[model samples]
Target: MSRLIKNLFALIPAFTYRRSHLAPPVQEPLLANNAADSTVILGAGIIGLSTAYSLSEMSKQTIYIVDPASKACVGASGQCEGAIGDFGVENELSPLNQLSYELYQQLAEQQSGKETFGYSGMDVHALSSHGFNSSDPHLPWPVQEPEDISNLPAWLKVPRGWVAGLIANQTHCARLDPPKFCRFLQKECESRGVRFLFNTTALSAATDASRRTLTGIKVLNKGSKKAMNIPCKNIVISAGSWSEKVFSTLFPSSRLRIPSTEQQPAQDWIRLKIKKPRRSEAGTKGSCQQIWLSADSEDLDIHMSSFLDGEFYAAGGFVDLSDIPDTPDKVTSPSHVTDIIEQNTREFLALGLGETVQAVGSGRALLPRLTTNLPIMAKAAWDDLFPSKTKLQEHSSPIAARPVGDDSDVAGGVFVSTGHYLDGFALGPASGKVVSELITGQSPSVDLSNFGFPKADEESGDSRDN
Candidate 1:
């Protein structure tokens, strides 16, 4: 049934936008006054929409989401292969990843009958040259050896040089269609009175005279030659890789800067629709399995998964950051990146399993750090925003004491939630929930000490908080 729905959706024109299943048709033009008294959320991706939806559920305040795209999930969120797995088991972010997984399970339960976001349990296999072994302690999930290789699908032909494969506990991993999931979130937010300003670019944040408190944001309507200031009590920057650029423009002179976030060279993937062979012909059930492959000699890792419609997606390879232009066209895939991914795909699946190529694409994500690999999610530092001790002490009390208002409040407020890197989708829900807690002055559910901003004296050139 889900596959049928997906195929129906695939037939729609690529440029045609999906309407909100929950919100009423937007009847008013996006005016500054419409956002007055709203909690303005920047960026309409998964993080931004998730935060907005969480905020709307908790607060009666109007919610306004701004994005340059025509709809949500048009950026990295859309490009993601929705593998909701706790891939951080051996790292500092393991707890957070687990929390996100649980939250996703809860969300799936809540949206049970109304919509299908392509959620399903599946086994994830890790392939390597070392051969299958259950003794690997680094993998958090239980591992088991397959009974025989004869039962495996024909498309999963092991590479010539690889000898080992381990399957993760089937309960630990799940899959969803990211684009569809994001649209569901948008619909829920809209039903909760969230207003979306699509095709709107947030140029900068408007702060008070002291530059301590954010009053509103300056936004430009890309469709019309008009600009306006939308008064907001609290502003959350969830703009993914572009968060730092937006933050810098809003507070150009602040002593604390979001460390340079670099864009990873793009990764490309090809989607192919194939005809499933008969069980008699393939000698098996013909189930599509997800595969992860890595070898000691190869620095790159290959990830492959298949959809219900017999469409397989395979992605691999990396490009040098220096080779990409600052404002390169994002809609088009780079030839070099595509070529490398194609080569990797062919090497991984040597059987040529597909009947027709459906789509080819690439994604370049901006990571918060090139070093310690931790996401930044906290309030802007006082000293960095207000260097003068006298001014800091003078405005500190009032800024902290100001009460929340419908339109705008004087209390200083600037929050950042980015730098999740490759785990953005895996961690996005939890990140948004935590950021909302911070904005609302509620205690965060998780200990965020590791995710906080570095003190001025201890700051390094890198973005790592540790």
Candidate 2:
């Protein structure tokens, strides 16, 4: 029944934008606005929406989620192909990932009933070599042998053991219709009294000097070009790639200037910028464009296999830098999408896969990266505070208040939750919950001290998650 509902939900439109002047269709529950302690959320992507929903439920705060796009999740999150798995990466072991996974399961339980969002499971299959020819030479067939399990890393190893037909299984991993899920989230938030401001662009945030906090935001109604100020007690900058821009506007002079040490004697100030660098090197430049493969029923349970016609086919892996702009926060170009499909087709044939599957979709995402590939998930340092505020303030520097060594107990209010890259969907929920816990001044539901990213000094070397 859930599978049938999932199939039916696939037919529903993910989102439909209503102009600023035009109100959404009258739905009683959707019209409720009990949020009083307003929280101005910057973006309407999955993370922002999820956070907004949770905040509304927990605090009943007047939550206002605004976005310039016609509807929520129209950005990177909207373009997703619905792959939700941790892949057991070291960075994914944090409490944020676990919470996100749990939250997704809960959301699935609600929507999987009558309002499917393609909430179905899948299996992660491994192949030793890039090529294998079986009955269908067009497809790269998996080598069926118990010994093959030895090739998989310990982290990816199955619970019982790997057999010829199946390798390992991630029971909770699922594939979702990204847009539909976004819409469902919006609906759920609205049901819980969160107000969504569509077609609204947050130009900038105004601060109250006396309070030493954000006062409100200036927003533009894209349709009428009218500007309005949305006042709120708190502002959560949930913008994805656009976060750096918002932070830059809020704190223009923010920079990480480190004096060069003995090895490299030079002093320079590196601007705090967010960018999505292409995953390509000189020689390996288009080597891993596309990927397509299949596992057996044992690898993916019957429930998950239903996502791929009760088989176990998955494809559409292509890497292209053409659409990625050097500047952050810009939408990936359609030309990049074209290249994705083209290169994906090439990889399909190379892997002996006959033709690209229509069920498969491709999208791109940008992940926050430190110099060493690990994420920077710490409170902004006191020295990095707003120039005007820090100049005359007598409070302790944000640097001094920074957590001693990756300990979760950092400064209050401010938090960091980026760096999922391609796995944000699999890990966004719990990350939001942690952020909520921090905001509410409660012990985090999960322990996050060990794997949490830390604040580093100039003398400290870059930290790698591997």
Candidate 3:
């Protein structure tokens, strides 16, 4: 059994090499002319694309995805490490995580012959300061002692008495090349008659005269200064950190509060290319090994993963969010990013790992984090007191109604699905599924009350219920 395990590990590099080169199937021509009667999806990140794909599969409406970036997943989605699993997730979110994993499995099965959105099952290890408990129910894998603590991989730095927990290899945990996955989703959505409008920004939403129902959106084409209206029956906002900004443009007066979504502090990431050693030095200290490490210490948390292509991805060190630029292109201090890379490398060196740095960079756009640490997925509401069918002249008039809350009777056509924060990729598919169901008036597959918008009392700074 041990010999078989070694042999299987040896074949990983070759398998990864082959998989990396496999091209995704060609995409069909985009149906760009279907904007008028389409469902406009603002933002082309994983959340938006996944929602588009789900909607296309269940409905025949034309899906129009609009984004300011040149392509999808250009923000936090692209910068992520692409690890998707339920480990360390809160209990409330586990169901969504599980659902997403199942959806990904279905997607992989559908594309049996193609590169699988960079999907691969992986073994994960968590280094904890506390002793390992083999009987922990939360741990899907068995706890095992490290094979060689003294001769551990040069890149792993753990305290002498720290315990290592090995997640069962058969667990649902997985990893993927995030950008590749995003591209695959885009292709899938396109093939299903979804239209994409890249390099275009959704300036604002247009609503009916009473401002009770969303009717369309005003978009600005970056390539051409031409502006146009995209009439849609429903509007779905999955713009991540920018969700508030997008929604506010439509209902500026509606105090539909979303807990503040702030950008997380910037961190540094480094990619190191391990050089192949000579045959004589094959099992030596410099030999490359696939390592997946998640270590939590008093001061910092580190996540590092090594790929089959002799590349190691490591991210660490947090700086104030104010230190980073709001846009990816405007990162003023490259040295700061480099400093973080060096700091992480030093930690790896402490573990005796020899790393030859190939690339050092920082994510220009900071990741958005929500205060509640739960995603916001719910419909917008009009003030209940307002006449449902006010004349066009009173469209611009304000109406007195109870604040936006779960119990409010106002019903609007806009749906919000954001605040997944760092778990966007892990929860993207499930979020899309639920949002699609809500749009179609179908029952949600899972209870989404926890992910729904904050109730009136919660939004008003009153937590008496809790």
Count the clashes in each prediction: 4, 12, 3
User: Which residue ranges in model 1 land beyond 4 Å of their true spot?
Assistant: 1-27, 30-36, 113-115, 129-147, 151-154, 159-164, 209-212, 261-265, 275-288, 295-301, 320-331, 343-357, 360-371, 381-383, 386-412, 456-466
lDDT against the true structure, per candidate, is 0.58, 0.44, 0.57
Candidates ranked, most accurate by lDDT first: 1, 3, 2
Candidate 3: stretches off by over 4 Å: 1-36, 127-163, 167-170, 210-212, 262-266, 275-301, 317-334, 346-355, 360-365, 384-412, 459-466
Between candidates 2 and 3, the TM-score winner: 3
Tens digit per residue, CA lDDT, model 3, 187-236 = 78878878787667777766554435556778887788878887776788
Could you give candidate 1's per-residue lDDT for residues 25-144 as a string of tens digits? 362554445333568888777788888877776677777887765667655566656667654255566767778788888888888711468666545556666554444322223336
Candidate 2's residue-wise lDDT over 1-466, tens digit each? 1111111111101221211212342322223232225677766776677777667767755777776655666545554445554334343244455566667777778656224675655443433232343452222223333335453322122334323233234463455656566677778887877777766676776665433455566778778798877666556655554554555665566553211121201000000111222222201121111112333322221111222211112223222232223222243334443344344233322221232223233223443322333332334443454554555544645533443233243223234444433444555566567656655556777665632333364224443221
Compared with the true structure, model 3 gives a TM-score of 0.73
Q: What is the model-wide C-alpha lDDT for candidate 2?
A: 0.44
Question: Which ranges of candidate 2 are over 4 A from the true structure?
Answer: 1-36, 85-87, 110-115, 127-167, 170-172, 255-363, 366-383, 394-416, 447-466
In angstroms, the error of model 3 at 366 is: 2.7
Highest-scoring model, lDDT: 1
Return the TM-score for candidate 2, rounded to 2 decimals: 0.62
**Root-mean-square deviation of candidate 1:** 7.0
